[model samples]
Target: MVVTMLRLRKAVTNLTQPQFIEGYRKAQLIDVREPKDFEAGHILGARNIPYSQFRQRFKEIRPDKPVYLYDQNGGKSARAALFLRKKGYGQLFHLQGGFRLWTGKVKSK
Candidate 1:
């Protein structure tokens, strides 16, 4: 388990707000927060897949595309990245400080 976790961690790339935003436009931006959090405010163009539902709904994200993930404070997204990595995802990224530190364009429901 430890070895697998180490490998997964090596696969995930943590990105700063600007780096995340620059790649977000071209990648599959997945907001791993819950529905209420997503509806309150989320990065523009991000899709809500709530971390709670990820095990059942992860397929909604295309494995072939670059995957960018973020949560309210980065913890959930880190776990999400590990989950995706174990499922054979190659290109994985997450916001360093999560959405709270994001200073980019956002939209709300």
Candidate 2:
């Protein structure tokens, strides 16, 4: 991602699966994995904003709403949260274990 904004060390909330499932309906659920990974299987209703495309597509996610993010593991989502926080996004949350550990329903193409 481009480094055009201030790099802030803002803390993003890490949610367990139960907590994530509880609030994701009211937030923007973003899957930060690559498209292929997203296409294979992802949380139901999640929007794809792959880490590779985050710099260009992040604006598509509303900064006003809470954002819930995840990747194959927690790493990419954590990075995406850092990037989004730098861009002035305040309400950030990520699945603690990410998609690989998600026990909820998923959508596969």
Candidate 3:
């Protein structure tokens, strides 16, 4: 049997809040922000992988679908994306501007 390798591309270079919100259900959103920041606010259904624990929990993430990583400022998410790539997670993507630019409702504390 032959195996196929799946590759994921950054469809949107600068993803906006509305765009992300619209694709929320269709994508696997991962929030790489710190606990406090994530607790303060985040897009709906986004999983908190916190950069600190991301490497350790990488296996928990599903590689079959597109992964959307985001942080408070986008930088951390970028780093997380790189980490995922290094770990052979080709189907990885990150929110262009992180949660700061997301216009969706945030979870209450």
Candidate 4:
């Protein structure tokens, strides 16, 4: 007789704008768009870690906290989420419509 434990991994969730905003103050906001897009405008407090640089800069993100991500239209963030998940990140969330559809307070460079 043998016993084995199987662990399942959770996937990132697509959070609506409201739900995303509700936890903005408490989560790590990551803008996965390009630097130019991020410079134009982005959610306040979000760090611009372009998806292009994600692999090289992933170390900038902490795996312990809740990470909320967004991109031009959700595609990039989804990809980023998958990468993060592979790297052992458990708490991950992304904006449903990405920055192009975001209607929240933003900061500009």
Residue 60 lDDT (model 3):
84
lDDT of 1 by residue, 26-106 (tens): 999999999999999999999999999999999999999999999999988989999998898989998998999888898
Q: Which candidate gets the maximum lDDT versus the true structure?
A: 1
The models' CA-based lDDT, in order, is 0.92, 0.89, 0.71, 0.87
Candidate 1 to truth, TM:
0.92
Off by over 4 Å in 3: 1-14
- Against the correct fold, how does model 4 do in TM-score? 0.89
> In model 4, what lDDT does residue 9 have?
19
Clashing pairs in 4: none
Error of 3 at 81 (Å): 0.5
> Which candidate, 1 or 2, has the higher lDDT?
1
lDDT, candidate 2, 45-76, per-residue tens: 99999899999999999999999999988988
RMSD for each of the candidates: 1.9, 4.2, 6.9, 6.4
Model 1: which residue pairs collide? none
Worst 10 residues of 3 by lDDT: 1-10
Output the TM-score of candidate 3. Answer: 0.78
Ranking by TM-score: 1, 2, 4, 3
The C-alpha stretches of model 1 lying farther than 4 A from their native spots are 1-8
lDDT value, residue 70 of candidate 3: 81
- Model 4 residue 82 lDDT score: 81
Q: What TM-score does each of the candidates earn?
A: 0.92, 0.90, 0.78, 0.89
